[model samples]
Target: MVQNLTKRASPHNVNDRKEVLSGSCIEATASEIIQESNENMTVADAVAQMFENLGVKSAYGVSGGAMASLWGALSNSDIDVLNFRHEAGAAFAATEGYFASGNPTVVFTTAGPGITNALTGLFAARGEGAKVILLSACTSAPQRGRWAIQETSTDTLPSSGIFTTGTVFNYASTVESAAQLPQIFRKLAVGMSQPGGYVAHLTIPTAVQNMLMDETQLPEQGVSCSLVTADAQVVGNVAKLLRSGTFAIWLGFGARGAASEIRQLAEKTGAAVMCSPRGKGIFPENHPQFIGVTGLGGHGSVMTYMQEQAPVRTLVLGSRLSEPTSFWNQEMVPSEGFIHVDVDANVPGVAYPHAETIGIVSDVKAFVLQLLDILEAEEISESQLKASQPSSLPKPERSPVEAGSESLIRPEILMEAIQKVIVDGTDAVVMAECGNSFTWSTNLLRFSQANRYRVSTGVGAMGHAVTGVVGAAQARDGIAVAIVGDGAMLMNNEISTAVKYQIPAIWIVLNDARYNMCHQGMKMLGMTGADAIIPETNFEMIARGMGAKGIRVTKESEITAALETAIAANGPIIIDVLIDPDRPAPSKGRNKGLASQGVKSTSEQKPKVQASFPNI
Candidate 1:
């Protein structure tokens, strides 16, 4: 099935080949090309070009001999190739980069442990709804099960989910021949063109990567796919349901693109809006109609609104309403049911299956726009909407800081500085790692714009933000800050990677010398004899050692100055703040959820200070 090309009048006329032989008969077959015609065009190069055509601007991973060809191909292309210290860090960074720039990114690994190490971040990408592709090396057919160096084969790795189209990836395959490029490219192009996130994997054997590919085998640059939208029947049904009774809107990360439409809908119907932790900025948090955030690190104002207003129906836009978002709290459920809209059809009734749900599979933006259209056509008056609105909506409140010069800084004071100096004062993207960092930031900070805040509520990995900030900063070509705890900072960080690339990323380390969340949660659960303490290591010293700027903040008053300095710096910087470990984060809801799940508290010693926020 090999095809050959003859000398043409021009190189561009030879099936659009950028490199073609002049005044020579091209005698190479599809599998093998003459050196004079497609000079040095390997299958790896073709794959890299295909990715570039698909709009991939960056590739991040650790390079090895097995993937030397791909590394060279990607390096030579216009895409920025970043050599990372660890494969997991690269994958995490790729995930954040896709979210920051709205462009799919690539994670390359050699084989075996390199591929395995990237699984965690890849899973996080899937959970957080990011488009990422993993390109890795695998053992050739001749070397299969023969104990090749860094062997990657079916004998060593399970192929069910990793190498096949299953839960882990929307599409997965092994590139055994160059001829498969057309189908692979089509699938990827279609997947990337569709709504929502799409994660894929393509494993190419080291030997096969060097094979020559015909120009006809290369995939086209792009594909066109229609947006997923609700049909008129579904839209009409949903509008009727919302019009029948009082309904509120629940926003999630998936609804980020429809911010303006969501605002219009909320204002038109006078419905209260609540969002998940990851969906913080999708709707303006400062708006009067915004009740509060829901789930872990959420506000009591949301619960207060639910109890007082007691909407008959809830319009859930793109939220999964999972444990972290709702804790599956029966109190939050409306009397009538939920009119849930999402791109994935399965997400509708899964979280709260017992409750009645009318699911509509459509892109959040398209669905919201259609709903607004229906409302507009109905000519719903502003006066009628005002009659249904609540007298006064509950607002989230936080306890006032004492403003003392304590030896250790308060988390509230640190968050206040972040709110003023970074969140509001600048356009830097802010991300909070899991544990106490997420709780403190989500519970305190307020966002007025979409895509300014990021948190991994799906996997909730510890080192995600620590390593991901680098990718975000590089992709956006601006300042990206990570609010991380000491344990996460010590576990995994890309200070060296950021320094290497000179990306202007910032890390604010809450140096409490302990896994404070674990320590505090264990105490709250009445667990005894648990060790969550870590040695106090100066993160500023670590950052400085890695050839990046560093600053240490020991007092609350020093936080603002340190942040201002870090933001002003042109390169990576770490602000190590000695935070008070005794102050409890707002995690009572999570503790209560754990208790209900049969986790019994065994000790009598309770947390000394319980951080409480009033429901305004």
Candidate 2:
């Protein structure tokens, strides 16, 4: 029904009639309904205001005519719009913005290919639970199915990719009319306010973008999102298991704010600590109780501890226990029992079915604090030992870099050089891309604070770190060091956006001339690495082409100086470092499962980690 937006046009309330009568009385359909006050403003202006109302101050996307109205309106407002070379890069950058600032950002794109091009990052955002607003321009209703240029039926709001029901987002819809915007904005407020990341796609038709609307019609911003502590039964159950036997505490990104309470609980219960890769530094990894990182280039200390100590109970806090982090191994899952705490109720018991599990749904911080109180009332002693990762699980020895100027730099030595150049929480933030970059960074570098380290283990997208660094550099008020592989840097528009914005992002490209992860994984499967190989390209030239500083490091002696130079640059820089491809990551044997299923291939070459100078 077309409801009256304001009380009947009165004798003296001139603004009321001027607000609702600019067009016909406010109209809404069954699918899209809105009822609120009125004002005199264009639909574009109202949408722009919706952004500010939801605490989002920045957005990233490409430009096209279909979204020109939104572009113009945003240009007139305080919102910062960052234009990028590709929609995927823009979307990834916005995802980083949310990660860095805790405020969801926007990704604006035109219809059809523009929208489809953004799906990769959107999928990444959903996978990682990063809050992002995907605002796209759609075809007008009249243009639907008429084969209009760049037109598709977005009206139905199909359920695929990020639009499905089972993921992080619970709502997805397009603006059917200008009147529907108030309710749409209400949903936006709710999504942004809630816990866990949310990705909402609001597609506006070109015709509707030009329609008139009212900013005052938007509902009042809702209450802050709140999650209860674990219910008494679940909390008591977890406490009982924790007190009864040898238990280890597992942490993740969700356990970020409760570091002190978590540490206290671990000490009281005599538990060791292990974390997901993204959860590094949330609990001091250097602490003794922190046995090692769980998956990827994770420490062998985990295997040693599990096989040796064999904790009778494991308390998992705010982690999915994903394949990349835990290798999805039977060994990683506890043999005795499990206690899993997560904000989402469904995630607690999902990863380990073989173990007796207690699932607790609550805020990580709240749960830890209350659990500490309970443990205190029951009198528990400090853990018998505090074990550091390096002491318990030292890094494997590297092949000696001969005393020659021509030898390629070892990956661990490169990481140490980068580590020396960092200030932990101040000077730079490390964003590691997927594949070998992830393994090396997670296994080699150590962080001292939360958010200082970031990896897309959930999304595991190759090119994410390079482009996402642009937004991180901008939002974090510090330099962003993107540890990326040769294969990933070439896949996105990292150099273009970084140069355009003059961001202080350093790309440490491990120029191995191959998708080394695939190369190594295939070898483990008894296949050759030939198809994974690519001719080594001079990435220094690529950076210089984009008006950014560039450097190439081939030897150990050059790494320290190169990192120092790149980190000191006034704008974006790329340090293309030659790493020995065959210096297989220390966690090489973690993939034995793949080795078990190896097929009989014609040619199989053993990985090369032995040190020798190769004449280039």
Full-model lDDT, candidate 1: 0.85
lDDT string for model 2 (427-518, tens) is 57889898888888887787767778889978787779988988888666558889999999888956877777777888999999998888
For each candidate, what is the lDDT? 0.85, 0.74
TM-score of each: 0.91, 0.86
Deviating ranges (above 4 Å) for candidate 2:
1-40, 154-169, 214-216, 379-405, 423-426, 588-616
lDDT of 1 by residue, 157-261 (tens): 899999999988999999999889889999999999988889999999999999976665564568989888889988988888777778889999889999999
lDDT of 2 at 63: 81
What does candidate 2 score in Cα RMSD to the true structure? Answer: 8.3
Q: How accurate is candidate 2 locally (lDDT)?
A: 0.74
- Write down the RMSD of candidate 1 (Cα, Å): 6.2
- Model 2 clash pairs are 270-383, 288-387, 288-388, 289-387, 295-325
Candidate that would win on lDDT: 1
- Cα TM-score of candidate 2: 0.86
